[model samples]
Target: MSDHLVKVSDLQIGFKNEEGELIPAVRGLSFTLGREKLGIVGESGSGKSLTGRALLGVLPPNAVVSASHLSFENTDLLTAPSAELRKLRGLKMGMILQDPKYSLNPIMKVGNQIIEAIQVSNKISKAKAKKAVFDILEAVKIRDVKRVYKQYPHEVSGGMAQRIMIAMMLVRKPDLLIADEPTSALDVTVQESVLDILDNLVDERNMGLIFISHDLNLVSRFCDRVLVMYSGQVVEELVASKLHDAKHPYTRGLINCMPTLNGSLEPLPVLKRDPSWLGAAQIGSGK
Candidate 1:
């Protein structure tokens, strides 16, 4: 038994590339996430997003996944029956994905969609469910819940839609949340507000949070720990407060490469990756 809300070990996920060869998207990743928020940072193609999706069993059909140990709330994720996974996903784990355009129903009103998300997890009347939905919206700092709820996905601004997504995902008060670039589509001001909202909700619920992004500076401020991923592998892990002291050359390269407020954008730092990191971990029995 562990205190960590989620644990993963030697996890692997790969898919057939256009060349018809298995290309690993995530390799031998191991980490433990607890009530405090943790950030996974890396450049594009670093497999940060894929790693988070793997935790929730949301990987695509092309993905071939395996793990020695994957558990949430002490239950082995790799072995949990579909029935059990379904129940857990409904009430105990929430995910806010990158694109609400594809995630939300095109024809449904925003309010109905949020209420439906809640009703899917628990038995509640429409009126009670609407109240719960509004409370969540308020928690995320979206005022005029009534107006926004009645509006369609197309009617709301990108930032408003994002807050609604956050609120909807939180309807069940899940113990774990995996936020994949939650604020990428918003303006700078809205991005900061969303970050603050996440900070508050996670603190209030004492939930384990996995925030994935390519932005190292934001992660430094918002998370308790940070994992630096490179070429489908986690090359470094350190306390967020001490992220500047990350040990790996890859981590150093990434930080040195990031753009600064005053620095010109012409020269972006790039890390040189190795090929051997693509190999899969040798699997064992009953993983």
Candidate 2:
């Protein structure tokens, strides 16, 4: 087996405007993932979520996706049949979307939803699936598993809902997990707890994690490597710990723009945009 779990090269995603012109959203993005957490950090609309969605074959119907090479393990995602893609989703690859309110089914009990996910990925009986669901709920630090099992999406707090989402995705024990701002809605303590669960999964299961967020400090502490994206392109890729040593101006600007508690009282530095970055050499070449 190859060392990489996912391979993407020259991936481009766009949508046709009413005028019938292609407006690119993700341009020539290339990267590879192994059994490690890779963080993609950028502002909103920088193509972080789009890249994750594209990998899962979950992009909108109007999306135009083209790539030189896009593969998951040995399967070519770009040409894979819908059935094949469906089978891979939630079984071999799972995504934890940003908002649980929109992601979860409002009418179904949370436990049933997770049980369905487990059974859909595996041909397990409801009894066994329920056991697995409860186990995963506990794994994600949900204190009252039995109570949460019968509750609807709206019943749980934001933190608990996030954990339930994690449980739903992890019950199948996928090889790859894409977490888009998974902890954005949680408190700091809950966020740390969630991160710990992800850390354990990566270590125990050798799962490849794609953590997408705008929290640079959190990413630096939690991920092994970081991809700094700007305007739908990766401007810099470096070790998470060395983010302060970034060479790209855009990356430096992002770091500088972060508010500091004890630093200068003056206004934060504004990021100056450069058109040349769009055509620059791809930093995330996965070399």
Candidate 3:
């Protein structure tokens, strides 16, 4: 078996533009994941989420996807049959999207949603599924499980709704978890709590995580390794602890923009764009 949980080489994702031209959103991106937190950080249009979605074969129908190698736990995601990909999605791999408000069903009760999740891949009765749902709700650190379960997505606060989303994805105990800006919508305290819960669960379950975010500081402190993306390609990669010493121009620019408590109260540095950085060789030889 491969030591890595996920491996991608020369992956490219593009969409059709006006006049039928192919507009590349992600190009020549390559990375490998193991049972640890790996952060993908970039600006709004850097294709961070696209990379995560491609791993699950969940890109939009209009997208054109190609990769020299795209494997998850030895299964080739690039050519996997639709039925096989569906089977792998929730059972072996799970994704937590950015906002719970849009991701969750506004009309469905949270409890029933979770119960459905537990029953989708496993052969379990409603009674057993309810028991499992409650257990998972507790695991995600929901204090008022019963009350929250009975409520609709619109009834709960953003943080609480996010916790329910996490519970839904994790109840299946997938081998790989891709969390795309999971805590971006919550308050500071709530964000920290969610990250703690997620970190603990990943360690306990020995699951590989691809945490996608725009927060460099959070990724530095929370993830074991970090991949810096710029203009749809990985520009640099370094250990999270060594983020301050990043060498790539794009990585350094991102670090310079983050505000520090003791630093000067000056305006944040503006990131300088360079056409040369677009197709440059990524650090760690990912090119």
Candidate 4:
């Protein structure tokens, strides 16, 4: 197996507009992931989520996706057949969507959903799969597995529901996990707990994690390295601990926009955009 779990080069995602002209949403985005946490930070429309979705071939029917190189381990994702992708999706590469409310099935029991996830690639018996679900739910910190198993998505709290979603993905023990703002809706305290659980699991499983979020502060603190994107381009990549020392003006502006605890109480500085930034040279490999 390759040390690089995911390698994306010159990736682009485009959608057809009303006039049938293709407009690129993610342009020339490239990064490599190993068995560590990599954060993608940018504003809502900056193409962060779309990049993650493209990796799993979850883009909408009309989406125009192309890449020079988009490979996961030894598999070439762009050229892989649907059957091959299906075999790898949950078993080798799992994705945790931003919200469990929309992601989880409203009609089914949470435990059943997990069992279904486990059986996506495996031919295990229901009894074995159910036990796996229970064990996985417990691993994600759910105390009453049997109780939560029978409950619907509406029955569980937001935090617990998110944990259940994590458990569903972890049940397969994927090598690469793409989490898209898993804790955005939760309160601050619950958010930290969720992140802690995610981090611990990624480390314990020796899996690569791609954490996508709009919160720069959270990304800097949680990820091993950070990729700062703007207008569909990754302007900078830097070690998370040295985020404050970033070279790109866009990265610096994002860091500056974050409110400081000890600094003066004056109005925060606005981020001034530069059109040339879209065409600027990118910096640093995540390594």
What's the count of clashing pairs in each model shown? Answer: 0, 0, 0, 0
The number of the candidate with the highest TM-score is: 2
- How do the predictions measure up, each by TM-score? 0.90, 0.97, 0.95, 0.93
lDDT of 4 by residue, 1-287 (tens): 88899999899999999999999999888899998999999888899999999988899999999888999999999888999998888589899998889899999999899888988878899999999998888877788988999999999998889889988987788888999998787788878877887888787989899999988889989999989889888998888888889988888888888888798789998899999998888554565
Best by lDDT: 2
Q: Considering only N, C-alpha and C atoms within 3 Å, which residue pairs clash in candidate 2?
A: none
* Per-residue lDDT of candidate 2, residues 117-201 (tens digit): 8888688888988888889999999999999999999999988998999889988899999999999999999999999999999
Model 2 scores what on Cα lDDT? 0.92
Q: Write the per-residue lDDT of candidate 1 for residues 153-256, one digit (tens) a residue.
A: 99988788888898888887889999999988878887888888788878998888999988887898889988888877777677898988876776787788
For residues 1-287, write the lDDT of model 3, one tens digit per residue.
88888999889999998799999999888888988899999999999999999998889999999989999987998777889989999699999999898999999999999988888889898888888989988987789898988999999998889889988998998889999999898888878878887798778999999999999989999999999999888988889989889998888888898788898888889889999998688555322
| Model 2 bad stretches (over 4 Å) | none
lDDT of 1 at 170: 80
**Candidate 3 TM-score over all chains jointly:** 0.95
**Poorest 10 consecutive residues by lDDT, candidate 4:** 278-287
Report the number of backbone clashes for model 3. Answer: 0
- Cα displacement (angstroms), candidate 4, residue 249, comes to 2.3
